[model samples]
Target: MKKIFLLAALIGFSPIFSQERDQIRERDEISPDNSWLKVGITGGVPVGDANNASSFALGADIRGQYLFNPNIAIGIASGYTNYFGKDGFDDFGVIPAAGFFRYYFTPSGLFLGTDIGYGFVTNVENNDGGLYVNPQIGYHNRDWNIYAYYQNTFLETDMDIQNVGVGVTYNIRFN
Candidate 1:
């Protein structure tokens, strides 16, 4: 009876020990490569108050990224958003252009990044310019990606705007 119990314990632990050994081997075999480029499009709802009016903006963004190494990458993105007022006031449009530096934490392509850029907001007749900072979290696979970010818009005057958005992206890899 004791021998059968010992056999059962070994059988249960053999696969777990083998999996740990394989993970150690994988860590030793990882290397950096920089031969791929990915481009994607994303659309989402932007959470913010549009000039004291309770409204959310619909936004779309285009992204281009190049792998400099397995762990580091650089990219650029441009986004456009618009909010319509509830009353007879004018609608507002915003254009944001930014660059990003990304650090990948896993080979499966989970990343965190920061972006800095400027946004131009325009109404029917007047326009204003603001600087923006966005901190983002994202995941990338062979052909699919998703991201979420929070943006802060700082105008030259004292007006400040904050936005939180979540987006899903599909990538086209260039040959």
Candidate 2:
């Protein structure tokens, strides 16, 4: 009876022991290789000192990013932002080319990022390019991103132009 019981238990447990171990998966399942391009549109209000110069802002941008891991991404971005003058001021635009870093919170789809680079002034005479910084927070999924940001440009003329804005992006995955 003891020998029969031992044989029965071993037979019952054999399948469990023979199965392969589970493999670890990447945090973001959307991209196995982790590279993508994002194209988007932005709209917002000119704020603080910028409000006196312009009332509304509108723009479009494109970004290329590589995910170093599940939580971190480094990228380059370029965009055009047009500020509509309030009344007497002439309408102007800025073409911003920036390098950025982003940190994502897993499962929550939330991210924080910052862009630092140059803002080349356009459409208005006598104004020159300047350094700019944009800090942002957003929520993203496999194919979409929605974010809000504050962009500040420190111009050569001692004027600081800033905007409070929201943007939405569609992501295209590569591998």
Candidate 3:
């Protein structure tokens, strides 16, 4: 009787063992492989104290990333932001040229990143020079990415500006 009971237990456990083995195999098949160059365009509005006004800006960035492992990638991007105003030359035009480090937290494409660089604001009456740091949170799916970020601009002169913006980026993937 004891032998019969042992045999039944082993038969019932066999399917679970098979499933575990299949899962291991599938995981190995899905291991991370990253070898691609990604380019994207972003457009959004900037709200700040110095501008005291709302303006729209567009940017373009290109990145070359090496996927060391599945979930980790490091890359650099250079981009520009142009701000337009309605009336005259006091409207600030900012060109943001920066480099960034990025990380993916999930395979579904959620990410966190930080960028540091110089922001050249042209056509300003009082101040024209500043540096900026932007920390951002974003999500990417197929060909679309969107983010919300805070920008701190430290001017060479006394006046400084802080901006909060939400942006949408579209990715153009070239094989």
Candidate 4:
């Protein structure tokens, strides 16, 4: 009797399980024309004259890109980067607004990219924004990106801020 009951239960649930599997298979199909947003965190140590004032750096950013094909893309990115102060210095930050370009070595993994724009200084007075450039290399897949970048900001005050950093982003797709 117990063996017969077990058999009956399996039969009852088999159709439900198969239906779920079919739904998953349908959802797994991805289209090439989709755009994606990458949301992530970034951190770095100050280089050049920036080291004299900042001990380290940390920030977050969001980037949206439209794929022209499997390998090339263009996008815009914006984020905040904070430079922690050294002794007797106050912490400073920059809100960076940039346009970026990327080339993927493969359809979904490994790429090169760069951002060019302006960094608006924050938490300081009597200052204008600066030129911002970041060149990066990374591994990208359907869901994540891991990268290393060099960031530079050329200030009008005759100072240059530089950083060598690593960042990670999670990709969210839209049709």
- Clash tally for model 4: 0
Is 2 or 4 the stronger prediction by lDDT? 4
Superior by lDDT: candidate 1 or candidate 4: 4
Over 1-175, each residue of candidate 4 has an lDDT whose tens digit, in order, gives: 9999999999999999999999776644444344888899999999998899998999898998887667888889999999999988899888889999999999777899999999888876676679999999999888889999999888878787788899999988876
For residues 64-106, could you state the per-residue lDDT of candidate 2 as single tens digits? 8888777898989989999999779988888888999999898
Name model 1 segments beyond 4 Å from true.
1-51, 124-127
Candidate 2: segments with Cα more than 4 A from true spot: 1-32
Model with the higher TM-score, candidate 2 or 3? 2
Candidate 1 global lDDT: 0.67
lDDT of 3 at 174: 37
lDDT (tens digit, per residue) of candidate 1 on 73-161: 77787777666565666556667788877787876778898778887776634338689787889886656667878766677766655
Please give the ranking of all candidate structures by lDDT, highest first, separated by commas: 4, 2, 1, 3
TM-score of each: 0.67, 0.79, 0.62, 0.79
List pairs with backbone clashes in candidate 1.
Answer: none
Better-scoring candidate (TM-score), 1 or 3: 1
Could you tell me the TM-score of candidate 3? 0.62
Runs in model 3 lying further than 4 Å from the true structure = 1-37, 86-89, 125-128, 170-175
lDDT of 1 at 9: 100
